[model samples]
Target chain A: MTAENQSFQPKLSDSPLVVGNHRLSSRLIVGTGRYDTMEQMRASLEQSGSDCVTVAVRRERLYDRNGQNILDFIDLDRYTLLPNTAGCYNAKDAIRAAKLGREILRTLGNPGADWVKLEVLGDSRTLLPDPTETVVACEELVAEGFGVLCYTSDCPVTAQRLKAVGAASVMPAGSPIGSGQGLLNPNNLRIILEYLKEDDPEYPVIVDAGVGTASDVSAAFELGADGVLLNTAIAHARDPIRMSRAMQYAAMAGRDAFLAGRIPRRLYGAASSPSEGVISSRPYGTLGKGDQGNSQSGEG
Target chain B: MVEITVNGQAVNLPRPMTLEEVLKRVDVPPNYLAVEVNAEVIPREEHSSHSIGNGDELEVVTLVGGG
Candidate 1:
């Protein structure tokens, strides 16, 4: 739908999404990767209206002539920079990455620099998280005073373990990383949500990774997800800028729909119009003279 | 000469130097870089005192695009 024709204003919950004591109004988090240029990344981020963006810690471009850095393009004042350990494969490496991110943030004087998006992949093929290593890293990072956002599979047990280990937010992947499969096992996600909410109703459960399009994001929010972290869905879209806007609106729509309860389904079709209106002149069981005697007659 | 790896690239320095001096030699802005010596993070406050020796492995990381 065109922007001019769209009139639905989502009635989002007044309650803010809280993660590690930081309250956020926007539920959609975008990433800075996979875009063709930094300009596209910036535009998409602006269009998405995301309050948070993830960045990886890599080697500095010490010898580049252009002297352009990703940080230079991003507005630190507008977005909360969530540094991630995307390349790290083990707990030790992930911990070091997190520490390095904190150091960089400390130098920049960002208040939320201590927060890290901890991801430790098990292998290179699937790019799935290693649950054992993830738990170990979460414990250490929490002890080191870092607000850890743990990424894991859509397993309720693993999510509970991460939360128990002091992860500020439990991010369960909808599917494999960068696969764009989009909520492959929604029933498992539902169970995770139910289990977490049973323990604490306000616990933040963000669906991270494997969101292909706007509908995937909306579905996650409809499943009672607190937030969504996506990169390829917007960055790799045919038109990243437009896709970003679509994702933003979809997130709002999904959250509002979840809040507004839906109706139950039945075997028989139910009429929405008033049944008391009597437009026919014939009696309940009596047929008019013009009507055929057969029940299959075409008379109304 | 002291040989060390910086971001997985081997580099030879004339002599042992502090992390701060190494950063200046490499032309990296200290405020935007995080230094890790031998896989351990060296806080900004310790850059002046932290020394790089022979065969030391240093990883200087800056923020980059990621999901």
Candidate 2:
């Protein structure tokens, strides 16, 4: 039953996700933040099954000789480092952060030297992106030849606008950053996937934030998202390494399920067993009866 | 001597020196760092020769954890 069936290889069904000038074997992108220690961050990232890791550009802790950098714990040869413009609220400052990130990566000779996770926040409280500033930053980055992965709210029009403005990847948030809400608006995300991947199906549409658990990651992929980028979902977990493993499996299963295609949703239950070969009448006739026909089966 | 701001802290350099000299004097990690002076990025190659100036605001940045 096994020898002759070995003609099919599992690799046949595998497809890599393509971002700006990069091809990734993993659909999940995890961040190197919020872990209590560098070892935990490293372990979580190792379990996350991601080929790319995001880092923020911040002031080099001056005068503290004992300060440790995320770079010391990360392996550039194994993972591509994606630097982000996290704390910037304006296009000008975001642009500055992006440049600083690029310079740092470039100096380190990491492959992510040419790209950025562009985030231009609006209100400090909500941390929602200002669409206007984001657009401006996207154009400027594109002009400067950086592969811009733009993050914005789950607005279909904004997603489309980011794509039109030359964002390498249009990452729409499932909810507010660090909210841990799992896909608050799936319909909006569906519209975004449709709008962004209409003609260019290979265009990467990553669900960027508000992933609470492994199910959230899978839900995003099942919604036909190309990838999911998360941080606090793992970092805030009770056991980050285990959660990271769960997330990895969820990503694979969800993508496979999406590719397998789900059956249509129906209002009524459809019996898996054929009614033609029924051995006996329904025992709980009252269940389907009162709910549908209310017929009494005397043979019960 | 010239006064320059590095990472928002005012520092009085004993003498005007190249960017690398200032980085060495401050004892910051030379790897994975980017220097921005007056909002303009200074490439790595120029750091070894670029001279520090009076009242120049510098921002030295590196990669940290975030998403």
Best of the candidates, DockQ: 2
TM-score, every prediction:
0.89, 0.92
lDDT of 2 by residue, B8-57 (tens): 88999888888888878655567768999899999989998899989999
Per-residue lDDT over A1-300 for candidate 2, one digit per residue giving the tens place of the 0 to 100 score: 587688755653768889999999999999988888888999999999899999998884632244776788899999999999998999999999999889888888899999999999998887889999999999999999999999999999988889998999999999899989889999999999998888998999999999999999989999999999999999999999999999999999899889888878867755544455558877756455324432333333
> Retained native contacts per candidate, as fractions?
0.87, 0.95
What are the per-candidate TM-scores when only chain A is compared? 0.87, 0.90
**Where is model 2 chain A poorest over a 10-residue stretch in terms of lDDT?**
A289-298
Error of 1 at A72 (Å): 0.9
Q: How many backbone clashes does every candidate have?
A: 0, 1
Q: Which regions of candidate 1 are displaced past 4 Å?
A: A1-13, A60-67, A278-300
**What does candidate 1's lDDT look like per residue over A1-300, in tens digits?**
988669778654557778995777799988898888888999999999788899888874643345667888888888888899998899999999999998998998876697999999998988899999999999999999999998899999999999999999999999998899999999999998998889699989999999999999999998999999999989899999999999999998888878886667655444444334548665587744444432332324
Model 1's number of clashes is 0
